[model samples]
Target chain A: MSLSSTNSFEKSPVEKSDKGTPDHGECLKVLSLVLDQEATDEEQAYFKQHIENCMPYYEIYNVDKAIKSMIKDRCLNQKTPSDLVESIKSKIYQQAD
Target chain B: MSDNKRQSYSQREKEKTFEQEFLPHIDSMYNFAYRLTFDEDDAKDLVQDTYLKAYRFIESFEKGTNAKAWLFRILKNSFINDFRKKSKQPAKVDYQEVETFYNSEDVDKSITTDLRIETVQDMIGDEISNALNSLDVDFRTVIILCDLEGFKYDEMAKILDIPIGTVRSRLHRARNLLKERLKEYAQKMGYKN
Candidate 1:
């Protein structure tokens, strides 16, 4: 598929939904807040209801969820080298002395 | 106690506080540095420089504030001012280049020929990390700070020295770019269009 084709699908979920669905942008915002665990109880409930009833909202929610899970699983999994801590401690202490 | 001895004692106290307050964030600092530089040696140097600067400016750092955020701010500044300037590697493609290429008409033909979405589907950690690293530094930094380090939007704005609105927009763009890079893999994982 063409790059433009791929990108067309990748447009901001807030911006891409049908024009008649005015609440799509609000849904997208609430979805983001939900993902970040920053949504209020009322907002979360609204989001849950929207996702259940709206196909576009469901699709956006699922895609965003998968992307977030992959990033959390793969990108943030690196263990900081053990010695690095001691090395920094020693180096900083040396400079202090 | 004598004035000279008192001064030394206060210095030691400050040093101890520095160690206690800031040292705990070494792992985080190192991880941030590693993600930014993508090189062990460079990450080490950057963390070391950050600590040194933190120590030097210890007097100015208010006690009991968000030490982690303060340290992160320092680390970020050093990365921009020092590490980027001294990097031995050739200059990276800036956001302008990436934007221009993606927006250009040739993108359609070039993507079909050069895109390797299938290979990325089977890939795991390093593959994903590479995709993130491939993003322009600005975009990559936001992901590292927000997704990886879990910085709040306002915290990120403070650390990156940008407005909160800028932070939101940048984070939005960063996530979009990352999603674009990993879209094939997401599709394989049953992500719907």
Candidate 2:
């Protein structure tokens, strides 16, 4: 059985809440803004702490990651370095060994 | 070693010294260019061009400003000027088109809403990369900066040469787009809903 099967995926049931997440949604926007540097340092620190403690806040960072994939794939996966990077890498490994 | 000399480093000297700084950032810049162009070959060229241009214009960089942002601006401009003009395709898209069709939000008409978080997190990087390539450049740039590079929003605005408001809106739109792509990728990857 392959884990990637679409059928294996389940849309987890929404757990009922008496209160709406207007503030949570607002917090999401705040964190989102933080990822872009729009939030104030105080707010940044606040959200940074919140994300460390909260799952939803971490979700914001993942979304940010999905967006950043563009540059990462490009920057990380380009042409092989001219013997330069390889030589340096070998030297470092040799020294380490 | 002194103030005046530091202030007056010629472009060639700047390059000689900054190459150490610049070399370390090359792969990141190349990856950025690759994602922006969606072509590995073009990505390499773009990165090379960005470094060359940055070397020539290092003097113009304000001493205290973000060098990464400066390089990104150069890479982005190079992408827009070099590649975007050469491609011919049907381009303007409302990314919401994809979002609306995949309406798999599971709410029982009552309780709390739980966003499916992990599978998206676990999706393959290449497929994820392709999804990013699908977005229009405007939305794509913000995602690239914030998500992959870990750039802050204000720093992103500074790098992108756009207002923070524009950055916010594009990021909002871009995330919605990525969610849509990931959902589809999930479907293909065989994740059952």
Which window of 10 residues has the lowest lDDT sum in candidate 2 chain A? A8-17
- Candidate 2 per-residue lDDT, tens place, B1-193, comes to 0111234566456755455565677666766776677776677667766766765566666565567877888888777777877785334545343222222231111013122456665666677767777888777777777767777767887777766555665676677666677678887877763
After superposition, the stretches of candidate 2 with alpha carbons farther than 4 Å from their true spots are A1-25, A34-75, A83-97, B1-7, B88-115
What's the residue-level lDDT of A28 in candidate 2? 51
Give the per-residue Cα lDDT of candidate 1 at B2.
Answer: 14
Give the DockQ (2 decimals) of all models.
0.23, 0.12
lDDT tens readout by residue for model 1, B73-191: 99998998888878654444343432332333432322232223343444588757877888888888888887777888778888987765456546655666676777655566664
Number of backbone collisions per candidate, in order? 0, 28
TM-score of 1: 0.71
Q: Each model's TM-score, in the order given?
A: 0.71, 0.64
For model 2, the local distance difference test gives 0.59
lDDT of 2 by residue, A1-97 (tens): 1121222112111221124332343345455556555666766665665567666557656655544554455435555456544444344335435
Computed on alpha carbons, the lDDT of every model, listed in order, comes to 0.67, 0.59
